[model samples]
Target: MITDVEWATFVPSALLLAATPGANQLLTLRNGLRHGLAPAVSASLGRFSAFALMVIAVAAGLGAVLAASEVAFNVIKWCGVAYLLWLGARTVLAAVRGQVAGEMQKTADEGDGKGVRGGLSSWRLGWQEFLVAATNPKALILFAVFLPQFLPRGAKDVAVPLLVLGAAYIRIEFCCACGYAALGSRLQSMGISLRARRWLDALTGVAMLGLAGWLATENH
Candidate 1:
């Protein structure tokens, strides 16, 4: 069991870590702004669900393997970096094309003549969001590396300590995510012109690209 003192100490750091906001945070924000709050929130849930699973898996076994193999870590790390860059490029392209591209996508989807599937579809959209949250490599690494730091030496069971830490981390993460989603959803209603939207997308894309480059250049 984590002492109250330890929990207090750990929670602040965990919250700070979560507050940094990365690709996943931006993705959730974009989705909320573009598709609406429900869909964005759904994605957040998927992401967190995956994150929880990764923490549990790492605590159980994956952490040891990751800790042991430098080569494996490097490989995964590079892959994650490359993926970030790819996503950044796509965001940039979307911004370059502006609202025409966004509207075109909507038009094409509507042309398919598929009727709205209602609330269930919204939930499914949320699941998609959740899955993205769950699968991000950065989130995986954070759990594997960050949560274990506060574990007491000679803890009776490693898993229990990991769980406590994981729960603390997730609590902060969800709060931050919800806050972002709410804010983005609000801004989405204010209605930007296509030109302004393009600029916003461009800025976000540049930020993502810079972040990706930083991640790629980081030493393990």
Candidate 2:
């Protein structure tokens, strides 16, 4: 188990990493834009639930095996890379097609759900976030490597402390997702010019593309 002093450092560290931009946050932003904040925030539970499973995997010693086995690690890494590339391309294409802005603006102005809903249900949103977090090898690395540093030395049961830290981290991560979703919701509420909305979406899409590159090149 972690002591109070360890908890102090762990909380801030978890918050810092939680706030770091990544695929989950990107999905939250997209969901908020397409749906609404409430559904987006609720759907984010799917991502953190995947994180919880990863912590369990780390506790069961599977994480070490993945880290040691290059093939397995590469499998997960490539999956994440592929998924991100697809998401980025889709988003960028939507923005670039130049057909959404006007329709979306009108929808926003009229308080209609047509442009916002996009026929995306909460369960679907949840499932997508789950896949994004589950497929990310770096997230497993965080639990397997970074989290252990905060554990009490010589503890007979390692799983408990890891679970505690994972729970805390999940809370913080959820909060971070909420903030991102909030921003997207705010943008939608503004009913700004079509150009502004289009630009914002384009920037997010480009950022996702850049993140994909970074993830592919990042040291495992």
Candidate 3:
């Protein structure tokens, strides 16, 4: 069991890490602008779900295997890079066509009576976010190292401690995601012109591509 003192020490660090801007937060921001708050929240949930799975894998000692195997690491890394690149291309294409793009188009059409089309659905967005979060080597490494530090000295049962800390970390991350989503939604509601929205989309596409490039080139 994590003592109160340990939790006190962990919570601040967790909150700081969660609040730092990263791919997940950026994705949530994009979702909020393109889809709405609901979809953004869903995406956050998907990210947390993936993080939970990673935590479980670490607890089960898979993290060691993954860290040690270059082939496995490269496979997951390439998959993530590919997905990000694909998503970036689609976003850029949608911007060029002046369409919402993805599943959000349907929702936007229904809500606003506008026929803006293209892009992925909320569920698909969530799933993609899940994939992004799951295949991240940094996250895997963090779990493998970070979680154990909080474990009580001489703790025999490791899984429970990991789950508890993981839950807390997820909660913090979810809150940060909500905050970013809400901020994005507010920006969306500011009545920007179609041209400006298109520009935003372009920027998002560039950001995604940049992330993909970083992932591909980063040293493991």
- Candidate 2 at residue 40, lDDT? 77
Ranked candidates, highest lDDT first? 2, 3, 1
Model 2 lDDT-worst window of ten: 110-119
On lDDT, the stronger of 1 and 2 is 2
Candidate of highest lDDT:
2
Please provide TM-scores, in order, for all candidate models, with all chains considered together.
Answer: 0.79, 0.89, 0.86
lDDT by residue (tens digit), candidate 2, 1-220: 3563288888899889989888889879876765557777878989988998998898888889998888888899888888888877877788888755754665565552333444466677788889889878988987899888887777667877787887888888988999998887777887666777777777777887887788899776
Report the number of the highest-TM-score candidate. Answer: 2
Model 3: residues >4 Å from true position, as ranges? 101-120
Kindly report the root-mean-square deviation of model 3 from the true structure over all alpha carbons.
Answer: 3.4
Model 2 scores what on Cα lDDT?
Answer: 0.79
lDDT of each: 0.67, 0.79, 0.77
Residue-wise C-alpha lDDT for candidate 3, range 1-220, written one tens digit per residue: 6562288778888888889877778788777777677667866788988998988898888888888999999989898889888888888888888775443445445552122234355567788779778867878878888878777788887877787888888888899999988876666667566677677777888888898899999877
Clashing pairs in 1: 42-126, 43-129, 43-130, 45-130, 46-130, 46-131, 47-130, 47-133, 47-134, 50-134
The residue-by-residue lDDT of candidate 1 on 1-220, one tens digit each, is 6672267678788888887867777766766555556566666877777777878877786866765777877777676666667666877787786753474245234432121246775566566455445434556666788777787766657787787778778878888887777765665556666566566666666777887787677765
